[model samples]
Target chain A: MISKFTYGEAELVTQLQHRNNQAFTYLYDNYSKALYGVISQIVPDRESADDILQEVFINIWRKIETYDISKGRLFTWMLNIARNAAIDKIRSKSYRNELKNQALPDDVSMLGDQFVKSKADETGLKKVLGKLKKEQRELIELSYFQGFTQEEISKGLNIPLGTVKTRMRSALLQLRSMIEQ
Target chain B: MNIKEYISSGIVQSYVMGLASKEEQAEFEQLCLEYPELVAARNIFELSLEKRAFEDTPHPPAFLKEQFINYINQNTTTNQSKVIQMEPAIPLAQSGSGLRWLAVASVIFLLVSSWLAYRFYNETITLKAELQHTKEAQANLGTRLKILEDYEKMVINPNVAVVNLTPMPEKSPASANIYWDSTTSNVYLIIKNMPKLPSDKQYQLWALIDGKPKDLGLFDIKDDHKVMLKMTDTRKAEAFAITVEKRGNTSGPDMDQLQMMGKTQL
Candidate 1:
């Protein structure tokens, strides 16, 4: 019954505290679809994305009490968990490297990109990223979207964590400046 | 770390993205505790990233959500039992209190169920009480109906012309008496709670003319049989008398049969 936007943060946490089925349903109903999209983008395989999605929710349930409202919104906290779980699955050595190279067929791949473009047109996500340099975009994608750790990003890009860190900082800074403007 | 250096150190972006190592995470967490400005910036940074991520992800099919929720609930139940039992020692962040939340939820559920059960039981008791009360009322009504039928039979019988007989003695303070009209020359008798007649037969009533007895009727008495006698004839009768007889009526009453007499002028 509680709409995601209209419901207060305290009320959301309280419902979660009680593990109210409706609250949980409302949560998954509202967030899962979009989260699946993010997971699919990161993991690329439908079956792996599905499995990791389950793991993501388990982590969210386990870690929900640790979520501090003063720090960020519940959606962000959950999204972070989801992203981390998916990336952890990706980083596991057992998962074949071919899974990484498996480019989404242009039809499915372009769909996700186009979906992003349309949403960005409405919310200015692309504009925010556009304000940053290409290097920052790559770091933001690797760290945020692709779920690469700084060590992985550092080794992959032939750079150090400090450099990756600087680029990422400058990336967010540019985004903040553009939005403020 | 100095606030300025910390702001410029690029860790804030990693923290916002959740890419920071454990040590860096601890360091950033401490900075957030120390500086409210740093906390505010982290929130802003996290929010922008969330918005971006949300925008990047496509709206999933609604069925996928059902699937996810099913998966989550199942795994959570399995994982909850594996969590550590110790509390207060572990930070709230790392503490395994998942099952505790479930327990609290179950207790709330149990309380609600018990309340519903209590209400249902109370309603059933009330309904049963009403049913018993209704049955008692019906039983009492049934008894009253039998008494009324007896009274109706006594009033409507034509062969018994009830004569108003006053109590000879006030043994029963509230008693009334009656006599039967034997003028029809037919057997008839009526009594109301009279004394028992002797056996061998019973008390017989006769019409007397100049001390000669005319046979009226024979009657039987055992306990409180209300009808005393039915006489054969009351014609030419000037008085009424009670006598004992054999089991059947005798042509004339013997002296032993004579018990009591009452003169009638009319």
Candidate 2:
């Protein structure tokens, strides 16, 4: 629900099918911050992140008919869209051209240093994830924030795929327990 | 498959992060279909991940949402498009709310300008029509002035003889004048003091030549201030007279209906 306007998720989906502006406004108000978080975490650059955020919603509009209520919630579908767009932005020629100017290092500290600037809210997550280890945090960050495949992440971290899966399971279970609390 | 075992496999987390392999995804989807508990776990994982993402929420720059709405509307109206680049995509989000206010002000300015343009166009057309009407009236007044000037010149001519017509004894207020130029044989009649006539009646002029009544023409009693109209042309006429007649015509003047009579001076 939005501040100036509001609608339930189910009714809002029906109105979104009709392509109403106020419904879209409500959608933006309710979910834009989380969606922006998803974009900025992956793209890691201000300009490209903004561009991808715009493209993400446009894709949502063009492909809203493809969304199945039975398959997932609206935020889930939109999260997928934002993550996809951010990944695509990182994969784009212009994004690579911009990155070519920077020194691309291959270590956790380098990536962490760059990503930490956008992690103002991540400090808050540290409190929620306080009991968890650094390895579990990095596992969740690479798989979720970086949108890396398990195999790709295993290769990147020079670890086995089975180890990657076990760490991912442990980290998310920790998060699940915290959420329950 | 045991739903607890499936939930523990971390496959749901992989699916939520969009990192699951195709085969793993397909199998997990089938399991979710068979078990509502798997769906619940998947939903829980999605919410937890969403909560995790809530950490990096950076206001997303206000313009990002504005650009997104514009892009959506543009693409929805058209199935396919080239591309639209909203400018200054970087850090402009910090001031994006100010930019939105500027956009709203621009739209208001455009609407007001269009309304003013339409009003000015209408006024221009109306003024042109009024100017044309005034021009036609001026031409009409100019023609009338020319005729009056010609009348004044003719009246002062040395060769012109002025004849005052006497009214009938029964109708003493009914009178007329004859301006006869003997040298040019241009005899004109001017009815001066005749009362209003019925619509079906008109006053007819007559030339009294050698005691015989000759029909000249009809004349209107109103508009007596203007120049006289030339009656029937004659080299020598003894007298001129006018009589009430039917609107169309009569071969001879009615002596009983005579309104005025005047003799030409020697």
Candidate 3:
């Protein structure tokens, strides 16, 4: 479902703010995959991930008025919303109970295997991210994908708080270099 | 500050990743407004992140798009109907006598609606005023938070010199502190003890450099003393003094009315 309508950032924001359905369709078609990937990383359950993705789009549609261009890119804003919604879903009581009821080791390991298999099927992103040091990659995963605070990352990973920040910076800089290459 | 070092200090990356604290985020944003290079560096990192997000991400099931579009369509239609429902409904008359009765009903309706409209108009005015007041309060809180965060950053900064301004021996006991950032040369003053001045008078700060008194700026004692009040930046200052000068007077400090003086340990 490739959109024939191509829009620059400003133009897309304007059309979405005006509640143009065509622009919205364009937005969904263009960005939904990336957003769904983020959701699935945090939420392993496919059905719940689907629901959260839908919720994220509905939220973006309703809350486009609140998006400030000065802050960051449209994708960054949408990514935050998607991550937050997925995190909230996992944190919810029902989701916790559902997880508890699942056959923990087998189900979780299978899901983890599937996740790795999917990533392995992808192109250079996995390679680029794989090139990062294990600790650096873990820092990025904890902070970016899991929405953990730096302090939380420090505590959970048993790394110093200062080192956590420095490692995250180096990880991103390294990733940036690899991507540019 | 070296913009290059600042950019690579991980503050910008932390900001882009949404991991920076509120104070750091605010400070980064303030710097971005002044330095275009920071914005460019930030954009580079953001673009890289966007690329990572775009490449090799699994697509959501195709049916989700259809569900989303249908949901939006249903919501928009419901919203339109809601707007239509907000308008006044009209009555339909069946016959001549019914029409005559409808005229009476229309007159009553007109009178009642006018009253309700008048009340709603007044209510709107009140609500608008309340909203304006709330906005002002929110703005005030934002400024206060910014100031507090700046003070925290400055106090913790290693290069910031803290100078104590004490009253002259002959004058009543009064003191204040000046936080001078050696790197940025930004000066901030916090009044500790001072007599209230007459409305026509204000306190003026002077930065004494090379035996000359350079006018720093004037400040009001009436301001909340808990927060540091920013003063003019001075690159070189051997000492600092405060005098009770006439309000808005920027002339040389009145040595006769010198209230407090402090020599820098630098």
Candidate 4:
């Protein structure tokens, strides 16, 4: 019922900072799913991603005053908040400490597995994975999706750190080309 | 300050994927303001990455919206009450912040307004182009209407001689008509049912004066189903006849190929 006219990103963010409930609700309806989607990729667990999602929107409400239009769009800002929060949840002391003793996280590949198993024909992630070389996909998986730093990736994937940076750059550029196509 | 080196150094990628530190993030923002290509690259990465992330929206739980909205309602009400208490603390925060907020708001307002004005200007230009096109089309139609009106007057005039040319007895029932205005010498031919000729062959019109045939020029079949082509404007002709002839170098009418003939009785 509140959907009379939609506002652009800058105006919507301005309204949101002004404590406009309608704008916030519209953002929530439009973006929550996408934000949750990104969160699930990093966190790799639905329940935790949901919790991180709640924290993200609440953080957006609390911290929107700090959002500058020059930095990026509201969506990109929200995305960073979601990614940071999810990464923090995954890389917490306990999670890291437990990784020393356990096998690879069951949920690390859960989202990947779901897409590859049932929705392999889906264009988005599966197609990207298909087009990417094995090493490139692993680099993207580790660096971008799994939230690994260049050093961490070099150590994790047993490649030189300098190689990691160049590969990451090349992989991202390739991803851009693939996305365009 | 080598931008290509800086860009290829992977800081922009780090920034895009939310891996850049605060200093790197600030530097990237500055670079974006300075370099248009960097801004474009940043936009492309931001959009593509966001799109990549957005693809995995496996139907969120139905309860999510209701739960989030309920929390929002509760939080807003609490925040409103807190706003009153925080009024005393606002002065401490308002020192340079108030002016900064005003400046930011004004800049945003100017940018949005100018962009809107540019868009409006573009729309006006488009409309003017469309209007000019319509006027040209109208002028062309007016010219066409004038020609049709002239033809209509010739058809209706008593001074205009109407000659209906019947096909030769040996020929098929192919027919043609001529509206010859002796006053103007405007000879109009309406070929009613001429056989579709070969590409090398053309239909020629001959106006007979004192029993000698003068070439009235050759014509091909027109695409328009009903067309009246103005043939050679001969002032005085005893008769009009259509003959099939080779496209060019026709010395005279081929008597063997006479399709239709009618004499001017007027």
Candidate 5:
């Protein structure tokens, strides 16, 4: 199903390329929390996630010219860059120095609660996810949430890599069919 | 593998997991070009996975989003100012320096005009050649400055991790920083104070894990003092070391000949 805030990806990206602040704000409204969730997973710290959020957008602004529609969706492309950027920030020496041997802070704990609350309010997507089989849901979750590679997922789940792939494919196929329906 | 078999075999998930072997990755990239539906499947799966992951977590702070937009605006303006202000100044300096040299040559001509026609003419030719050479050097300098700026930008990337490798006590007094992008899963070695290697040999980077060496990459130091080089597929590195290897690297590292090593804590 189409998201409620319906503008063509190309049109929105075009406006973004022209430095249209409203277009950017709209994009941020739609994707920021989600992107933040992804960033927090990789960085796992509130302050660093906050910093990486800024850096991700700055990079998105600078590299908007390189976005090729033929390659992938704008969301995926931006997500790729944002996720990569967040991962980089944590791996950077400066971040390591500041956060040396420190466990994730308390604020990060509240992210789980906040996400659940927001997700309940945004129930349409939640329902769609709820429709998936537990195994499929678990596969998707471990891969995305934990940032595990397929091999890691296979080993973690005690499934052969081949079976993991087949299960993931069927799971995704089902989700797509359900969403489109 | 045929396209159908490849799809059925779970290569798509392997692609999604980014765990596809090199040959598999190459084949999948080609399939992505040939099959639009395959591409769409990848996108849909990626989105489905992404959406689920996002919904599973909390909304980022509203302030963080606001901060991001504000940062973008500030950065754009700053970068704009840099481009607008810095671009012309270099050329202006080069031309200004050239003109100053011309002025100096004119004063020299005035001083030596009465000495001899042949000397005067030869000196004039030499000055003209020197001026051309200076202009060429200035142009090269500008290009080098731009490359250095690019390197600075690369470091600014949030995903690039910088590890400073200090010199070893037993070997040459040289040090370097390794910028590892765990996102791209690559590493870049930026050496400092390294003396020139002999003509036939090069420095090889090794990732030391639990007292074993994994070859990262090899490089030869340039005469221009170029010390920075980007390495590839740099995953699972605990500590980094450098060694004098043969012109091409070997499958295993020679521990006895290690030049420098540094443990990465931060």
Candidate 6:
């Protein structure tokens, strides 16, 4: 069992860099749920999402040295790692074949709601997302959670590249205001 | 340069979300280093994202932690051996051509630094010359601005009366204006439109009081219309006039040579 000791961001980073087991345990305990949530959003399949989450944590442990504090927060860096891992898993040929065999739901929103309702204890985020306009919500879901590039989003949504960038920005700003309130 | 506009332009959000292109990312990172406000704005949005992530957190299976710990233990052992293997290889390479490489590197460094120093010296000289030119231009502008302020003050003064001198029939097309300060009785003349005077000749002004002409002053035609030529003061004047004269003061105006004339309303 991990101890209840909390570490400040700087102290935790230093300990993680030194490969301290206690700090690693603390990091996993504090952040795994959030990372898992993000992975599930992209991967949708619980088993695959779990595997991706494990890989994300391992990658974070191995790459802690490359993390620059001046560039961004620890959680932000970890979020990118989680997102990239999940997106990579879904894009791999093996995951696509596995999807075919399982006959998973083709509709992303249906799969997403099912996965969210089953795994997430809180429904606050879903309701918050509901408050956003359809276009704004789609922009956020595609770019942030699914790790789609702006160009890919533009092509997929049948909107201009410039509009995709602007819509994503406004979506994030709106989300920020909602979270702050 | 507009930090507020840049912050709201969505570049910061794009940067935080990792959606900015490579060029935009590089530019934003450089700007973030220079502007703490940009860093603060980035942090605010990042915090919001973190909060959003937390709102939907889903607990991973508890057994995953034990697996992760076992994997870390195995990796740490392997990583230690890897580091140990890398250590012995470093000294072996250093013992081979290390001294020769050091000598060659030092010589190259010396030559390159000297070349860089020479270039820096030339750049400093060029920059100094540019700085001197900029300073001279700034001083010239300051003097011109002061003169403009004086002109504006004189023109706006409530006690000053403006008299537009009409061209005489013989001196057609030549015109001028006289600004007469009633309080100080000082007169100033500005040539609105006049042909350039010969090098040996100048224009003379006169103040007419009760039909008597008093010699005011002499002035040369200038390309700059803003140049206000100061003239002799007068307690009373019914009219003002100019005459072409030799470049000196004259006691009275030559009525036949009068170029322009205008009467005061008073």
DockQ of each: 0.28, 0.41, 0.31, 0.23, 0.16, 0.33
Error of 2 at A143 (Å): 2.2
Proportion of native contacts kept per candidate: 0.44, 0.53, 0.55, 0.35, 0.35, 0.55
Query: Which 10 consecutive residues of model 2 chain A have the lowest summed lDDT?
Result: A103-112
Clash tally for model 3: 0
Minimal lDDT window, size 10, model 4 chain B = B87-96
Candidate 4 lDDT for residue A87 = 78
Q: Rank candidates, DockQ, best first.
A: 2, 6, 3, 1, 4, 5
lDDT comparison, 1 vs 2, better candidate: 2
TM-score of each: 0.48, 0.53, 0.53, 0.51, 0.42, 0.53
Docking class of 2: acceptable
Q: Model 1 residue A120 lDDT?
A: 24
lDDT by residue for model 4 over B1-266, one digit each (tens)? 98887876667667877767688898998888999888877777678766776675665676777777776787787855674565455554645477766786899999999999999999999999999999999999998898799789989987789898989988878778899989888888877777777899998999998789988888887665445778656777989998889988459999899989999974
User: For model 1 chain A, where is the 10-residue window of minimal lDDT?
Assistant: A106-115
lDDT of 1 by residue, A1-181 (tens): 2354544667978887666656777777667765776676666566777777766765666667788876667877787787778777666654545454543232222322322333323333444665567777666666676555667667766788788667777876666656534
Could you tell which candidate, 1 or 3, scores higher by lDDT?
3
> Which pairs of residues collide in model 3?
none
The TM-scores, chain A only, for the candidates as listed are 0.70, 0.81, 0.81, 0.80, 0.61, 0.83
Q: Write the per-residue lDDT of candidate 3 for residues B1-266, one digit (tens) a residue.
A: 78899987777777876777899989998999989999998888788777877777777898999999997787676675563453333223312357677787999999999999999999999999999999999999999899889889999999999998989878878878999987788888887777788999998889988889988888777655543677666777889999989999968888999989888876
Local accuracy of candidate 2 as per-residue lDDT tens digits, A1-181: 3476567778989988887766777787788787877776676678877777776777677667788777667888899888778766665565667788653344433454454544543533444554678788777766666556778778877889899888888887776677645
Give the CA lDDT, 0 to 100, for residue A38 in model 5. 69
The list of candidate 3 runs beyond 4 A from truth reads A101-127, B80-266
How far off is residue B41 in model 2, in Å?
Answer: 2.0
* TM-score (C-alpha, index-matched) for candidate 4: 0.51
For model 1, the DockQ equals: 0.28
**lDDT of each residue in B1-266, candidate 2, tens digit only:** 57798787767766765667889888888887899988998888777666675664678788777777776676556534333333343345544677776886899999999999999999999999999999999999998777667567669988888888898788748756888888877776765667878889888888777888877788666754433777546557788888888887666887889988888875
Candidate 4 achieves a global lDDT of 0.76
The superposed Cα distance between candidate 5 and the true structure at residue B18, in angstroms, equals 4.8
Residue pairs whose backbone atoms clash in candidate 4? none
Worst 10 residues of 6 chain A by lDDT: A106-115
- Give the TM-score between model 6's chain B and the true chain B: 0.57
Where does model 2 exceed 4 Å of error?
A91-93, A101-118, A121-131, B51-56, B75-266
